[model samples]
Target chain A: MDPLILASEECDIAREVVCVPANVLDLFEFNSVPIFIGLGAVIIALVMYFALRKPKLVPGKFQASVESLISLVSDSIARDVIGPEGVKYVPYLLSLFFFIWVGNLMELVPGINFPFTSRMAIPLTLALLTWVIFVVEGIRKQGLHFFLDLIWPPGVPVALKPLVGLIEFVSTLIVRPFSLTVRLFANLVAGHVMLALLLGSAGFFLLGVLGGDISVLRGSIGAAWFVVGVAIFMFEVLVGFLQAYIFTLLSAVYIESSLHPQH
Target chain B: MIADVLILAEEATESSGIDLLIPTVPELVGGVLAFAVVFFVMWKFAWPQMQQLLDNRQKAIAGQIQEAEAIKAEAQSLLDDYRQQVAGAKSEANQIVEAARSQADTVKADLIAKAQTEAQGIVGKAREDASSEKARAMTEARQEVANLSIDLAEKVVGNSLDRAAQKSLVDNYLASLEGA
Candidate 1:
């Protein structure tokens, strides 16, 4: 079960507004996600603006670092994974990478402790965008035959052609975006939950020792949980970056596949 | 607060399973709208500037490389020309030296032949002069001997006979003695 949902249900039982609301409209009424998303976008825009404001032939330290990061996406992800044709998609890929990364890092922020990507809407939106782009690119490059390649793969024996085509259809059209969405969404949610569980449990025990009872074993367990929670929190930072990288890389791979479909 | 939040948790069976996976409409709408803004800002402004900077740098580097190659080729051509000029000058110098040596040899040979010819002409002129001087001296001595003989004969005759007869006798006697 999702820890946020668990927390929401607990909040509901206590008649309090601690976690996100359960009702869909109530979740919409909740404005924290939008505020954080705006903040992430603004931060990204400012960083990009400053990084390239005084574009130089000989780059300074800040410019070099920014350029190196852009190059990593251009060289390693888009061009490397999707070939020369992928140059056009660098903007989209760069945007996706940084946006998703900042969104994921929101979970670790002090006042705002929810990763925007932990919500299903953001990952779903990004994944759907990737799907639309690759599909459009495939159609643009290869024409209507793109769907034909997906539905009726070449080199299959006539007897097995139908089965293979069905599998390919589901795998290509359905699984691509679905997997993209779930992979990013699930990883961030899991990280958020793990942090919440560890820290919540630690605080419960430690608070009990300090406020109510001073038990040695409770204090030790609380200290251990807090230590582990801090460690996991640091690990979540890496997870945030990894998830962003994976999502962008996969998007590039899908674009490649669309550009050059397997016969 | 954390302990209270946790302890409040019970076996809630209300929302479970795939319901959690579903996305709310507002959040989805807001997320899409937010991302659209981000993508717009990035695609519209940032990317083009970055690409321009990169492209300008690339073109500048390429131009510099081409300029460097052109300079290197020009330098090589100049070096080759200088080497050819040096070789031509060396050959010309050798030819001048050879012509000067041959001219010196010819002049020396002509000088030696001229000296030999002059020495031969002087020796021939000296021999001719010596022969002429010896012939003159011989002719003078013979004339003196003949004159003395004639004078001795006149003294012996003592002037008794006529002058014409005496002259004839003396002539006959000298002639007869010469014959015998």
Candidate 2:
């Protein structure tokens, strides 16, 4: 038996699943990503189904509430960023935001504590979809010369064109989607890791199984940490909702910028 | 710390592992089947009815708005007609009052002029009758005066006057009478 493995085993097993390697951050893995994506898809279908199964003059309470929420998300995030012209994309953005949010929330279930969004693959895939939409939509709307708008930016001087063009194209092509994916993935990973550490450390502190001298002050601090962890977990629920919103909001803003440019 | 917990959970899962993974290839197949079924059901049941309901609701709203506008127009026209009728009635009453006043004035003047003419005609007839009566009285007096003087002269001349003188006077007298 390896001492390193033994030392590693001292930590909670759930923490290993939630944490990722430093080296593999750049690589894309598909294993758990599609599974969570599929889960999100199922949740979307059920929500749509349950909300729309029956027909009524006035909507049922649940359906009406869901409809209002959907429309609110549409009006707030989609309409505010993309304007009324982008109302057609409401269904896609609404489903995407909710699906990602539910994926984050699924890890909070008692027996089902694996944070799927903590994996890089899910956010990366969604970011890819968003980037594809923006690029395709920009070109489709403004023709192939839309790329020129990114480079020239319409109002800048000819002397600075080359430097600005290089910077703009690189940032537009790379940094935009990269930031979106990494922001969501990093937030999920950090939030999950923080929650696991706090919760798992409290267990060790209360039980005193770390083989060091246990004291009344350490145990009390552990209780305090445990309570604080609970409070943070509650706050993290809010963060889950916010991060999903930010991602969707950023994507919408990006699409808006891409489609029209600054010209 | 959670890693150790996860190991325990993993060991437990492995002892009675049921393969929770939903698989990859089957997803493409199941996704198609599921989406197709959902689309078909939506097309068959939900869409047609929802569209019909939306159309009917739009029509109902439009009809209500049109009917309201029409009623408003009708009410406005009715108000205008009533106002015009009231104006006409007022005008007609004024004309009738004016015509009656003029007829009363004309009739009053005609009555006044006719009364004056009647009074004048009566006065003229009375004046004519009085003048004719005065002429008749004057003629009767003159005939009586002439008869009385002649009687007196015959009485005086009958005894006083003898043959030739008396006869001369009487002859003068009788000659005068024949001449007159």
* C-alpha root-mean-square deviation, each candidate: 8.8, 12.0
Residue-wise lDDT of candidate 1 within A1-263, one digit each (tens)? 33344444443222331233233222222356777888888888888889888889989998888888788888999899998988889888999999999999988988666788977888998999999998998999889999988778777788988898889889889998999999999898777766765665566556656775547664666678789889999999999999999999999999998899886
Q: Residue A154 in candidate 1 has what lDDT? A: 73
Against the correct fold, how does model 2 do in TM-score? 0.55
The model with the greatest lDDT is 1
lDDT of 2: 0.64
Candidate 2 local lDDT, B108-139, one digit each (tens): 99999999999999999999999989879755
Model 2 RMSD in Å is 12.0
lDDT score of residue A234 within candidate 1: 96
CAPRI-style grade of the A/B interface in model 2: incorrect
